[model samples]
Target: MAMQDLDPSEFKTQAPDAHGQVSTLKELGDEMKAKLARLGLMIAEEAGAGTYLQRDQTTSLCSTRSKGVEVLPIRQALQRYDWLKDYSWVAVKADTDKFTRDAASAPPDVVQGYFVRGLKGQVERAPVQTCLYVESRSTKQVVHNIVIAEEGSEINIITGCLAHGGIGRAMHEGISEFYVKKGAKVTFTMIHEWQEQMEVRPRTAIVLDEGAAFINNYIALKPVGSIQSNPIAYLNGDNSRVMFQTILYGKGSSRMDLGSRAVLKGRNTSAEMVSRIITRDKADVVARGLIVGDAPGAKGHLECRGLLLSDTSRIDSIPELDAKNPDVNITHEAAVGKISPDEINYLMARGATEDEATSMIINGFLSFDLSELPPEIAKETKKLVDQTMKGL
Candidate 1:
């Protein structure tokens, strides 16, 4: 079916019962569809070719398109529909099979299906942005593939995943692949917020060619439930570089295992990873950052920190640095602890409530190293973090 023919409302359906309240899956899906439609309308109304091209599954092959910056508004598309708020129980067996099938199909599409599918050629020397949203209930898995190629091309992609309301017991798996060619650069930012009982697993992989660069920034604020994320990057060409930044906050019964790894296989390649996590109530979080420098002239560095807000809260940081080349430089550091009473007292003396003082200190910790993100996204993330902490 054509992308335009696919109505957002058609995909939205009421979620099954979970706990006592209604879920948000249907509402969120409808919102996503509307946002996508609005984005397409905006692109057409603006009538700017080089600056943007909005095509949903419709536009045919066109190589004459100039290499210029591109922007995709995914949240705007989702906003078109009402937000979904609740989900029903999904079997674990079915969810696992769906994920396995999708991964098995990815290799063929990546290797030879590119030509057969009549995919658009590389966007050489231009920046492109794409946004994505997914809403599912009853054990559903989603697979998304992304690729950017050609020399000097630059792309920035942002993705957001949110549960409609509260979930019973469901599993969500997402896979994304990025290919950066010689002298190319790609920056990816992903944000995830789920209901109290959902389980989310997100996996991403990127390959950087000669003189190519890739930067990834991820934020997860799920105060309840479980989330596991694995972000991997490979430097395959000379002078390639990769940087990863991650932040996670967990509260109540939430558990998260989030980390990133980089492998340096070429000369003059470098990788850096930095992450911070906060835990409260009975929540537990395990964060790992790994850098492997195997070739001469390779460099790698990793840093991670965690905050434990309650006595029952748990956090673990495992940073691994492996360097086979004597000329390579590798470094790693980690810390885990709680808020200092001195700082809390300092704020409380200034007429701030205990809860307010704690929230401000914790928020500051998560936002301190996030200066590279867009102001709008960073602000939203901070607000979410503050809201989550309030429930603690």
Candidate 2:
């Protein structure tokens, strides 16, 4: 598939505010509700502790039900608390790239993203759910998100990015920065489902303090025109830890480039990066991972696996590990291959059709041992994976 250069000025930056039209998710049309559910947004009590929903350039909902956590619009949060200036653009520079520059320079009328903060020593029982949807054609959505987990606090977040089917062409640029203070833990899970003609670019960076832990899970299953994302994490304090898991499915003539990098700069710090990619039809995919150990007693690992379902599809895997200290340990493993006929035939002999057998094998291949995730979020992630496999 041929790619075109992105021109920010060509897309509309303003749209009508639909926030007052719907008071709750249940009030939306049934079709729209179902679409949101597929991206891990629900109306149940356990859905999340807070909810933030944005449609085009308008914020439909932003509220926090939990006592210890605070959720507000980014612009409002910045105005309410002057201390936020110290954290903003600290983890991720505003001028890092073209996308970041554009997002940082967005007009004041555009709806900025949401702000989430976990107070010191407070733990939220449920994750915070946020959804960013593009409903207008030829629109440009620029969002800057910030997440802060105070010392000894823990918070989980689930973000969904989707594009309306009626919209013909659109672009999304998201900038996110996360801070995990000493002894704190933060988990973020993101699901992306967009139209085949949509383009997406997300820039994210994380900073971890002493004894902090961060886990990130990302999934993109639906067909899309183009997507490029590479998020980096810095373990700057002693005993800090970080883990990343990404799942990507490429279909039609889409192009996807996704990767993650981690730098272990603290003593005894550890990092891990894992990716699973599957391409069908004439799609193209590139999976990349990098881990650097810069302190003594630090450890890191990188793993990437790719599967090809069609002859015209393409998959590329790149894994790199670097150790600057003699006492550090770093390693990487990567493999790319197609389904073996013998394995498929074995499944077919057990009273299963060809398609069924193939699905079974793919399911088994995508199976993950993620004991770190909360039970509810884990179940939702599994459901999304199963639905995607069935669709394929």
Candidate 3:
């Protein structure tokens, strides 16, 4: 049979089967909701979107919820705010069924996302938030969100992912696409908080127009069974800018392979990729970053840092840069090692126990300078970041 002739949903481990057996647990109650809220999402809970999804008794499936009580689909959630009406869950099954490169132009319905309304030359005032919660057994879920900032406009978006208790092995796959038009700026922040047994895969891509800017921030503070992802950004127009910042903590027997790639294809384009990884227990982690400059006057930098908390844990940093233009500037740096005992001793000498001293060092290392983000977004995400650092 031809590739196009097969059943599109048959291979989907997260999609509904012939007998409609997609959910591992038939329904969820208050207990699971509380669990989801406390698992590194107290900020989201305070914002009233902690458990952004819930199960409807009649359907036995999960749906996006508003305020923990009102059952709302992503479409309806988009309708709540007039400013969000321009956005939607536009990706089709074609986008999420596979890891194809055409996701930005041809998105499948299986993907959940929206298209931001572009302003000819203005900034959007409201910050968009996409909160998701998955609590099903034998479940595999995929999310694909698209954002397009019109020329001369600016916008901010925050994406949060969470899974219910570790009942069985559950999976979540995600894809995101961003189109920054000429002179536009788009800032995106991703927060992943899943249980120990869940698996996650996130695929993201971005395209920038002349003078456009794309800022990406990623944080994973909890232990997961496994996660593998690589997000790519393309600076295709003159003077475009793309920066990626990430912080992760991998624990237990988890495995994490995360990376970011930037292609500077336009004159005077600039890019940066920074990542920090901390591993504990038997976790295996890799931090990968790459920047390619193909245009004259393009400049880019890549950096990766790691901290090993357990002797059996492993952390690897990979940084790469490819420059085709002699006039361009590109550089990369990577470092992986255990926390320095000298740093801990210094803190301990200042009136703290060994545990407290170690905690302080770990927290300081894991904490990021939010000054890199937009004012509003930085202010909002700082709380979540602080909570994550302390909890870990």
**For each candidate, what is the lDDT?**
0.57, 0.85, 0.66
Q: 1-392 in candidate 3: lDDT tens per residue?
A: 22223222332333322123223221345665454334333333224221233221112233222321222333344556565433332222234445333333333333343334445665653444455556567565655455677788776666667776755776665566677889998877878888887767667788898999988988887888777788888899999998888988888887888999989999999998888888889989878888899999999999888898889999878788888889899998888898788988898889889889888887777667566555555765666666766766
User: Tens digit of lDDT per residue, candidate 1, span 41-108?
Assistant: 11222222222211111111111123344232222212332320000011112234334344344332
- The parts of candidate 2 lying over 4 Å away from their true place are 1-4, 15-21, 43-47, 348-353
TM-score for model 1? 0.68
Q: Between 1 and 2, whose TM-score is larger?
A: 2
lDDT of 2: 0.85
TM-score of each: 0.68, 0.95, 0.77
- Which portions of model 3 show Cα errors greater than 4 Å? 1-111, 349-353, 372-376
Q: What is candidate 2's lDDT per residue for 1-392, written digit by digit as tens?
A: 33336665667665536434456777766766888887768732345788888887787878888887899888899999999989888888988977788877877667478899999999885878888888778888888889999999898888889988878879888889999999999999899998888888889999999999999999889998898888999999999999999888899988998899999999999998888888999989988888889999899888888889999999988788888889999998988889888899999999889998889988887876567777777788899999989888
The better-scoring model by lDDT among 2 and 3 is 2
Ten contiguous residues minimizing lDDT sum, candidate 1: 84-93
lDDT of 3: 0.66
| Candidate achieving the largest lDDT | 2
RMSD of each: 11.2, 1.9, 7.1
Ranking by lDDT: 2, 3, 1
Instruction: Compare candidates 2 and 3 on TM-score and give the better one.
Output: 2
